[model samples]
Target: MPERKPRADALRNRESVLAAADALFARCDSPESVTMADIAAAAGVGKATLFRGFGDRTGLIHALFEMRLAPIRLAAEEGPPPLGPATPPHRRIPALLDAVLCFKIDNRHLALALEGTGGGSPYAAEHYERWHSTLQEALEHLPGPADSAFTAHALLAATRADLVEHLLGQQRMTRDQLRSDLKAYTARVLGSPASVD
Candidate 1:
């Protein structure tokens, strides 16, 4: 059976909820502090609407995270060089990591909130799994016998939200400095062109 599209108002309410939730998370000191009631109040909808649309707090967070990550994912899936599949593995590998790192850096708070929902292990999250699979696929394209799965996990570990937050929030590392460090680390692992530095 064909699925029915959501009503226009329902869709609008969903967008409203996402935007409201995003603002609250961005402005709040902590992600957990932002609740469904807050989101519903901000969106001008009832808590029931939020629960009906998103199932729960975690689901809503995941949806919002995916929405924010759409642009980056689209670039990797179909966009141009350095991020798209057509690019060479070595270059693409680092580019993807750079993108993920930048995204987490840019949206650290929200990312941390989403990561926190992954049962205390960020690796268990669907978002993390998608990145892991993407990086692992890119890693496999390089020449050599490196274990792509392990290598991908190791590389991704450098960009986890908690670490990024600690480095940028508490450790006071500059954005450029963190990116440079990640680039260098990735280069050494892939023995790719970035390793020349």
Candidate 2:
């Protein structure tokens, strides 16, 4: 076992590095360009310490997912109230999309980096499954005969980071416009009329 003092210091250093990387990556739009030296400098640590904390770039990426995405997975699992007969489908549907959109916005760079590589992570899979399950449950509440599984897949595919980047960065769609269009598309795909309530 490692000494408590050294372990504690290592943990603190790791947190600092990750926090700096997350912020820088979010701002810069390209995590790959942010090197270990950049992260170490940002964290006020030596590059050696950064390397020690995470063995290599891939390890750092894995750690990022663990530190960032894990909580989202847990929250989506246990934090939100499950969709049921009592919950209105329109509200729940928009809420689900909003949660996903917020996540993409927050984790934009990390998500883009992860997608650039073909390898899939377990956390990504868990996210997709959670999204599909939550959406499927919400769709069940709606008055429709659409295949819930396919609909969930389509919804997620349409809301990917690449699409968001294109819409915001290239197409220059305003946030309000994106949200409005997403809501309309979701309602139409589910075969549900817009709610006035």
**Candidate 2 — worst ten consecutive residues by lDDT sum?**
78-87
Q: Tell me the deviation in Å of residue 18 in model 2.
A: 1.3
Over 1-197, each residue of candidate 1 has an lDDT whose tens digit, in order, gives 99999999999999999999999998988888898999999999999999999999999999999999999999998999989989988888889999999999988889999999988888899988988999899888888537999999999999999999999989999999999999998988887545532
Q: Give the lowest summed-lDDT range of ten residues in model 1.
A: 188-197
lDDT of each: 0.91, 0.71
Q: Tens digit of lDDT per residue, candidate 2, span 1-197?
A: 96656678788998998898888778875667978788888999998887888897667766785677665556555555432334466677665776677667667777666555435532354456667787788777766846877877788776787778788779998777787788788778877765533
CA-RMSD of model 1 = 1.6
* Highest-scoring model, lDDT: 1
Regions of model 1 farther than 4 Å from truth: 193-197
Backbone clash pairs for candidate 1 read none
Evaluated against the true structure, the overall lDDT of model 1 is 0.91
Q: Candidate 2: what lDDT?
A: 0.71
